[model samples]
Target: MIDIPSMQRAGANAVKAIIDDVISEKLDVEKKFSSSKTAFRIADLGCSVGPNTFIAMQNIIDAVQQKYQSQGFASHMPEFQVFFNDHTSNDFNTLFASLPPERPYFATGVPGSFHGRLFPDFSLDFVHSSFALQWLSKVPEELLSKNSAAWNKGRVHYASAPDEVAQAYTVQFAKDITTFLEGRAKELVVGGLMVLNMPGIPNGNPHSSSVTGLSFDILGHCLVDMAKEGLISEVQVDSFNVPIYVASPKEMT
Candidate 1:
């Protein structure tokens, strides 16, 4: 059976090429990095409980080490300190327990939402988040209001919903991502590099027309069917939402 870790690894692996390329070209190790023994801090925002996080972090460390070696600074390799961040409700104990026994970096857990500030200014040298940014800080308030045109009645997601519903999601995504970027800007040191891997649709494609949307539509139909059979309340279905937004390329820009 495919588990959450497997799924996370699959998604993260898909972006390995992008991560390597970005690190090789964009990361400035020579000028920005201190030759002293200060630890190189890294944060994995929205990192869920699992082995996949360790693998992804290790890949980053390996790439950075290669860069340092290529630039003739292998002997001056800085110590790595990794922060695993997630919502307060996440199972941090399990995440910590699952760390690789012989790992190189010192690991720490940070509990908080990524949309807000979670680190001191100019503290982090590298930031990484994979398959996580598509999540909104919260469900769009417009969807829960009965008087709003975007009220997500009989649906748990904006996929296949009216344009107003989709628009509400778009607005929330913009706000949440802006806050996230602002917080990260304050946290990263000068010339610091960040890698974000998110799921997105191509330009000109409606979210409802994508495979993920169709799946959500089916889920909504199932929930409505269950409501009709008196297995669940209509109110429950009406108030439910997945709080996930699949952005288009344009929306991301």
Candidate 2:
């Protein structure tokens, strides 16, 4: 089985590498911002209640400072303002309580789905999302429609399902991604960078081949068994679907 924390660590390391190499050239630190604050703005979209988000944000702050120092602009270093965004149901209190006591950045919690616009135009200097995009806004409605060809009768995910079911998920994902990209495009300032770290399968591979897919398959079977044993209704089992779409590399492109 693939360890989730390991994957998250790998993504964080990749983010660090990108920031170290290109951030200095890509971002214009001296540019006059529309906001009156003396702080550099960063948004971590889909940041769950965790220490990993803190680690990633710190890495960014350090890299930005290094960039300024290397360019002999250390005396005018900007304060850091970090926005931690996630679903409204997330435990913001816990996230705030666990923050590092001596952290340099001023943190704020923003609750909303990243698929929609959450920030004002040209508001963010850098944006980051880690291991969060697989979750769709909601389960594809076709999967729950008895009259639809894509109805996922006994399954809780697209994996190992019929082509119609998978296609339904793909279409929904495409729409959701378009909305997400448009929002980010409007939110990020000119010369700003956005780093996204999401799970994906290799090109030409079926989602069912991955561990996540297999886990969903197992869950679907368990639910079916439960229905058979009268623990849940068959209709309920038919209506339930996991709102995640683990895209392949091709799908992502």
Off by over 4 Å in 2: 1-6, 32-37
Stretches of candidate 1 off by over 4 Å are: 1-4
The candidate that achieves the highest TM-score relative to the unseen native structure: 1
Error of 1 at 136 (Å): 0.6
Residues 1-253, candidate 1: write the lDDT tens digits: 2244565788789767777777788777777556456788899998999777898899888888888888888887889999999999999999988899999999999999999999999999889998889899999999999999999999999999999999999899999999999999999988888988777788988888866688789999999999999999999999998888888878777
TM-scores, one per candidate: 0.95, 0.92
Candidate 1, after superposition: displacement of residue 131 in Å?
Answer: 1.1
RMSD of each: 1.7, 2.1
